[model samples]
Target chain A: MKTIEEINQKIKDGNAVVVTAAEMTRIVRETGAKEAAKEVDVVTTGTFGAMCSSGAFLNFGHSDPPIKMAHTYINGVEAYSGLAAVDAYLGATQPHRDPKIGIKYGGAHLLEDLVRGKEVELVAEAYGTDCYPLQNIHTHFKLEDLNQAIMINPRNSYQNYAAATNSSEETLYTYLGTLLPKMGNVTYSSAGELSPLLNDPYFKTMGLGTRIFLCGAQGYILGEGTQHNTEVERENGVPVGSAGTLMLKGDLKKMDPEYLRGATMPEYGPTLYVGAGVPIPILNEEIAQHTGISDQDIGCRIMDYGVPRRSRPAILETNYHQLRSGSVEIDGTKIQTSPMSSYRKALQVAEELKNWIEKGEFFLTRPVELIPSHGQTVKPLQIKRPSILVKDLKTKAIITATAQDNLSDVARLMVDNNINHLPVIDKEGKLMGIVTSWDIAQAVAKEVQELTHIMTKKVIVAMEDEPVEVIARRIDKYEISGVPIVDRDNLVKGMITAEDLSRLVCSRDDKRGESL
Target chain B: MKAWLNFSPEIVNKAVISNLMKNFDVSFNIMNANITPKGGKMLIEISGEEAQEGINYLENQGVHLTPVKRVVKKDNDKCVDCGACLSLCPVEAITIDEEWKVELDDQKCIGCGFCTSSCPTKAIKLAD
Candidate 1:
C-alpha cells in the first residue's frame, strides 16, 4: 500500500486527475467524445464519469471507453466509489491514533494549506453530490480513524450561499481563523450545546470568538422553510450523519485542543470525506425551451472552447484570485483578511442587495419557488371561531367558557380539570370569549370601580374563520394577554394566548401533545 | 530627656507657630482628653483629618463621640425585582431568577444601587 505522501506525489506527478464525482462525469463525457472521434487516449476518472462518458459516446455515435471503473462497499452497506475508496484505504493503513485528541479548526482553507504545505497528504477526494453526503463521509472516516479531528467550516457551502451578500473571501477567511485567537478551549456534549456556548458571558468578557462548523449544518436542517422530499421512506432513510458530525465538532471545539485529542472517542464514529459532484448541463434545445439564458450564451459557454479561452480565462482567474484572497470590511473596519476565505462577504453583499431590493431600488427578482411536498400547498392556520379550546387529556371533554364567565366558575373549571384557561363557546358551538383568572380580575375590578361607564363598547373579537394572525394582531394591538375566538353567530369557540403563541412559535416538532 | 506637657480646655486645637529654626503650616494638640486605666479614648489630634473621618474613627474605636446632628432619612420603599444593577454591583450582589424575579445575594450585595437604573422597576435606592 502506498503511503499518503506517495499518493500526494502521484497527484503532483499528474498521474491522477483528483477529480470529484461531478468532474469525473464531465471527464467521462469528454472521453466519450474523443473516443467517437477515434481517440483512445481519453480516460474517465470515476464510475459516474465513465458512465457519462459512455453516454456521451453513444450520443456521438462512437464506441465507449475500454476501462472499467472499480467499486467497493463500505461496512457492508454504503457503496463506496472514487475518493471514498481512497479514504478507506488511507484509514486502514494509518495506525489507529490515540482516541483522545484535541482539534483546532481554522478556516476552510486550513486543510488545503496543510495539504499544500505537505503536512498532510490528500490521498483521494470522496465523491458526494451534496453537503450531506460529504458530512456523512467525514463522520464515517472519523469513526474509522477514532483519532482527534478538526472540522473546519464543514457548513461553508450553505453558509457561503446564505452569506453571499455580505461575505467577501478575505472576510470569511479572517472571520473563521480569527475566532480561534479569542476562544478558550471548551467542550460540549452535543451541537445543541454550541449556541449557548457562543452566548456565554465568558466570550463577551474575554472578547472571545467562535465559529460554527457542522453544527451550522444541523441548524440549517432544523431551521424553518426547509424542503424535504415527499417520499416517506427516503426522507426517513436519509442518515443524519451530518447532524452527528455537527454534534461531534461542537463537543471537540469546546475542549482544549490537547485534552480533546486525548479524550475518549465518542461511541458514535467518524465521518468520511465526500466530494461534491458537478452539475450536468441540460441540452441546448431543452435549455432554450425552459431557461431565460440565451442559447448562444449557453452554447458559447459550454461548447465553444475558443470563446472560453478568450473570455472565460479572465473571469476564472479573477474568481480564483477572489476565492483565494478576498477581504471584507464592515462599518469601515476590516473584519476578515485571509486567503481561501469562503464567500462570506458575498453573502453580506447579497444581504445589502436584498435590502436594496426591498427598498425598490430596481425591479426585484423573485426566488424560484420550491416544489411543494407531495405537490400540496401548505395551508396557513385559520381561526374558525373566537374561543380557546382547552381539553381534558384523560376525559377528552372540551371545557367551554367565555372571557365573561364568572370568576368563581372559571376558578372551579380550572381546579377541576387542572387547566389555565377555558374556551368560551356560545350556544351554536361558536367561539365567543376566553376567560382566565386575569380576565376575571379585570372584570371584577371594572364592576367594583364603576369603570364600565368609560369602557369602550367595541370588544375587538376574532372570528374562528380568520387566520391565527388575526388573534396575534389583536393581542398586540390591545396589549391583552389573550384573545377570544368567536364564530359568526357570536358564539365562542376557543381562546388563544401569548403563551400559546410562544409555544407554537418555538416548538421543535409540529405535532402537538394531543394525547397529553 | 524630659517630656514636655501642656494643658488646654479644647480636646483638639490647631496652632500655627513660626520658629526661627523652622516654620510649620499647622499643628494639632489634644488636651483634657479622657484617659482611663481601662483605656479611655485617647484623642490624637490629626490636623489633616476631616470632620467625618474623626467621627468615623471614634465610632470604629467604640468611642461614644457625637458630631453635629443631621436629619434622619427614609429607606427606599420600592424594590422591584429587576436585576439591572447586577453587573454594576462591585460585589456581584444581585441575581435574577428564571421567572425574571430579582433577589439580592446578601453575601454579594454591597447595597450599592449600581443596578438601580437598570432595573425597569426602579427597585434599588439608597437608604438613610
Candidate 2:
C-alpha cells in the first residue's frame, strides 16, 4: 500500500515508475496486479472523441465607450450573451445564422480558429443604456485579446458508449457517423480500454480539482456531467455501456489546436472533438488491477440507429477486440465495424501524459471533493398536456352536394368555393359518397355527366372524438389527403385535411418556443 | 490502371466480368461495387501486360468506363492523424501506422468519399 504523497515523493527523487494503460496491460499480464502495483506509480489513460456537450466562456474586453452587449456573434455563429457585458458562452454545437454556412462552420470551428491564432470577426448589439452608451460594436480579435477564455465543457470522456448500426433500407446520417442501410456498417465512439473513465471505473482518483490533460493543457475535473449515471450493469468492474461522465474546465488560451478540433456530421450538426487524459496514481493493488483491464474484457452494446426514436432497439453486445478486428456478426451476418473515436490519437495522448509524468513536469493533485458515485440517474422529461383529438382541430365546415347533381355543376361549385373534396349527401344530410377534383377530371375525360358515376361510394371517414394521432396515421396509411368527419347516423359534420393537422403543429410551436 | 465500370440495366445480368477474365490475361481487384438488377457501377483495379486489352473488351461489352485518375485526395498538411476516417473506409484503405499517423493508400481507395465528410479538419476532398 502507498499514498499519493509517497508517489509524488518518489517522483521528486526521480525514482517513480510510470507507464501507459497499454503498457500496464502487458505488465499485469506478465506479472500479477499486486506485484505491478508495487513497482509502477502511475498509469496514464486518454481519449479523443466528439463531445457535443462542450463550449467555451469568453470575456471579450470592453469596447471603447463600453457596450452592455445583449447579442454577441463570433464569425457569424451566435453566442449566449446573457451574462454581464463583454461576456458570452459559445457552444460547440451552435450553428451560424446563415444556414448555408452553418453546417460546415459552427462554434466548434470558431473555437479552433481562435486557438490557432486566426483573426475572427466579433459583432455585438445592445440597447442603449445610461451606464453604457454604445449600442453596436463590430471588431476583430484573436485569442490573446480576450481577458479570460475558459472551456467549461458540460460533459466529456464517457466511460463507454454503444456502437451504432442501421437496419432500415435507407442510410441514416447521425452523430454516430453515417450508418449504411441494412446494417452495412457499424461505428462505435470510445477509446475503449484506453479511455480515462474506463481505467478508473469507480472514480477513486477522478473528481473535483483532479488535474487532467485537457486539449494538451492542464485542467481539472469540475463535477458530474449532465446525464451522468452510475446505476448501470457492470462486468469485470466496468460498465457495459455509458455510465459515468465528467464535467471538465480548462483555460482555452493554453490549449493546442491539434488536440481541439471542430467536426461536422453529415445531416446531423457540428460538434467538438476533445482530447483528454487522466493519470491514475496506483495507490494500491486494486487500482493497479482496474488499469489492467484489456479490450477483450470490455463490452459495448450495439444500437440500431435506423429507429428514429429516443430509445432505439439494442442489436447485440460485443467487445472491443471484435470491433477492432474490422467486423462483427449481427443476426448471423458479418458487418464491418468502425470507430468514431480516434484510437491513434488516444494512444498519442496517453503517451504524451506518460512522458510528462516521467519527465517530472506533471504532478497528480488529490481531488478537492469526490464526485457522487451513487443516487444519480437521468430522469425522463415530463410533458404536461392533454391529448389532442380530431374535434379539437379547426376543421372546415362541411361542403355538400347531391349525387343527382350534374358533373358540371359539381365542378363549378368546387371552382367557386376553392374546395377540392365535396361530400355527396342525401336529402336528410347523411353522407352518401365523396368526390374530388381528380374525379371531375376523370369524369370529363370519360364524357360522364352524372355525379353518381364519378363519386366514390367507399369513403374513408373519421370520427370527431378520435385522437388526432390516430387520424394522422390513418391518412398516411390510406395515402389520402383529407377525410370527412361524420356523426353516428353518418351525417356529415366537417372535413379534416393534412393541412389542418400541419397548421396545428406550427401554432403549437409558436406557443412553445423551445419545448419539445 | 484503376477504372470504374457502369453496367446498364440491359446488360447487368450478363457475365461480362467473367468473360473478361477468361478472354484476357489481366488480373483485377474489385475495390468497391454497387450493382443491382436495375443497374449499377463497379470500381476495379486491373493490372498486367494485357490490361489494355481488358479495357477494350469491357468497352465493347457496352460498359461505360470512367477512368479513376483519383478518388479522394488527402492534404497531409491539414490532417491531424486523428483516425476519424479510419473506420468509415469500407475498403480499409485508411490505416494508422506504427507512429500513430493516418496513412491513406490511394491504390486501395474505392472513392466512396465517406471519409471526406467525416473529417474534422476537412482535410480530405473528392478529386475534381
Candidate 3:
C-alpha cells in the first residue's frame, strides 16, 4: 500500500487514473446530495433509455443535476401523410420497372418486415387513378427510383377511429402510471364516459396492466367533447393539427423493445424514475414561491451556477456516461424518461434537475451500487516529492545573489540540471531570491546597452504545500508561466511551470497513436 | 524585345485577387489600381484593402491584421445609471454616471472578449 505522501506525489507526477461510470455513480449515490454535489464538478441529465438508471453514481456531490423529460409522440395521421407523399413522389418518378421492389418504413415497421418478408407500399398514382382523373395531372416520371413498390393500401377508417379512441383512453394509463403518480395527487375527469365494457380486468386481459396509482396533488379537472380535426390551421397558417396530433399520439415506448434488449442492466433491479418536464414546472413554482424571485432570474442563476461547477475535472470524469444519458437511477432501477440520446440533451437535463433539487420539489437519493465498467490500471509516471510548501506560483521568488554567484554560474546550474529557474539560498539555507535565463538575459542586455536599469528589488515567494490547482489558477490568472515551490520552512524544493499543469491532464491514446 | 512588359500585369492581378477571395470573405471597393516605375520596371498597385484580403495582397501589404475583432458601441439613449459595468469591467476602466455609456481606457483595455461578449445590447467593439 502506498503512503498518502506517495499517492500525492504520484498524482503530482501526472499519473492517469482510469475510473468507470458505475464506480463514479456508486460514489455519488453513497455521498448523498451535498457530498455528491461537492464531489461532482458537473451533473448531466436526459440520458434516455438504458442510461437513465445509471447517472446518480457519478460523484458524491450534486454539482450538476438532470433536467429534461423524455416522452414519445405517436402520430398515425402523419405517418399516413408521409406514406401518401412518398407514394406521390414515387408514382411521379416510377423510376424502377420491377414491380417486386421493396419499400421500407421507420424502425418499428422495419423490424416487423424483417420478421415477415412481405410488406406493403402504398402508391399515389394508383390512388389518383382510382380516386381522381389522370389527364389533369402531368406526371413527370424518373427512372431507377429506389422508393417505389406495390402493395394494398390498408385504408381501414374504422381501424384509425378505434386507434384514436383507444389512444385517448390509454393516455390515462401514461398519465396515471407515469406522470400523475409521480406528482403525488391530482383529480381527473373525462367528458367521454368510461366504457362499461372496459374495466380493470379488460385492460389487464389486453396486457395494459393495472392502473393502481393516482396523482396525489390537488388540482382542477376539466373535460370536454371535442371534434377531431384531421387538419387545423394555426395563426401562422401552416396547419398545426397534424404535427400536434403526431406528437401527442406517437408510440415510441412500444417500438424500442429491441433497443431495450440490447441495454446493459444495472447491478440492482428496476426502480422509479422521473422526467424533466414533470418536475421542472413544480420546481420552478416552488422556487418562485420560496425565494420570491422571477422564473427568468431563477433560470439565469441556475445556469450560471450549474455550468461552471460541471466544468470541473473530477465531476466530468465521474459522470461521463450520465452526461451522455439524461436519466438517473432511482432506487436501483434505470427509468428512462427522455427521448434524447445526445450529450447536450443530457447536460440540459442535469442542469434542470439541479434547479429542481434546489427548489425542493423532490430530494435526490442513492439508488444503486454501480459496478465498474472499466477495470483499474496503475499509472507509470513518477513525481518527485516537494521539499517546500508553496501557496501560489505567481509570486516572485526571494533569492540572495552573491558576488561569487554570477550570471554564468546561475546559467550553468540551470543548463546542467535542465531547469529554467533556480532560487538563490542564503548561508543558512533560507530562500533569499530567484534567478532565471530571462533574468540573466535582461542583465546582459542592460550591460551591453550601457543603460542604467533597476533590477527587481522586491521578491515574492510561494508556500510549497498549496494545492496544485490553486498554484495553477494563480499562475494563469497573473500571466506567470513559472514559480518556485517552497515548504512551510521556506526552503526551496523545485519549480513548476504552466507546461507541467498542461501535461498533467494531457493524454495520448497509445492504441490510436494520437493525442486526446 | 521590351523586357518591361514581359509579365502580364492583368493576369498576375487576377490570379492574386482570385487567390485572396478564396480564403477570405472581404467587402471593399478597389480604390486604385496604378502602375509605378520602380527600378525602370512597372509595378502594380492595389489599395483600400480591408482585413479580409487574400494572402498575396496581405503579403504584399506586409501589415499584420487580425481578421476577427470584437465590436463595441455605446447608445446614449439606452444608458441607465446602473453601475454593472464598473465592477464587471475586467480592466476596471469603466466608470458609472460621468459619461453614462461605457468608457474605454485604451491603455488598460487588453482586448479580451469579456466586456464585449458580456454586454447585453452589444455596446462594445474590439475594432479591427
The DockQ leader among the candidates is 2
- Which ranges in model 1 have alpha carbons more than 4 Å from their true place? A1-15, A20-22, A28-398, A402-420, A426-433, A448-516, B1-128
List, residue by residue over A1-516, the lDDT tens digit for candidate 3: 222233223334434121112222354346543443333321212211111111110011111122111111111101222322222111111112232321112222222222233333322221232332231211222112223222111110000010000111111122111111221111111100010001110111111110100011111101100221323322211111111100011111122221111111111122111111111111122211211111111110001111112221111111112311222343353322211121222223334444433443333222122111122222334445332224433333343343246666666766766666666665666566666667778878766321112223233444565556666666776676776676767666666777766654353224235633
Model 3: DockQ score: 0.02
Task: Pick the lDDT winner.
Answer: 2
Better of 1 and 3 by TM-score: 3
Report the Cα RMSD per candidate. 25.7, 8.3, 27.4
**Candidate 3 interface RMS:** 21.5
Q: What is each model's TM-score for chain A?
A: 0.23, 0.80, 0.23
**Cα error, candidate 1, residue A140 (Å):** 33
Q: Report how far residue B106 has shifted in candidate 1, in Å.
A: 48
Worst-scoring 10-residue span by lDDT in model 2 chain A: A380-389
Off by over 4 Å in 2: A386-497, A503-516, B3-69, B80-92, B95-102
Clashes of 1: 90
Q: Count clashes in each candidate, considering only residues at least 3 apart in sequence or on different chains.
A: 90, 0, 74
Question: lDDT, candidate 2, residue B48?
Answer: 88
Per-residue lDDT, model 2, residue B21, is: 90
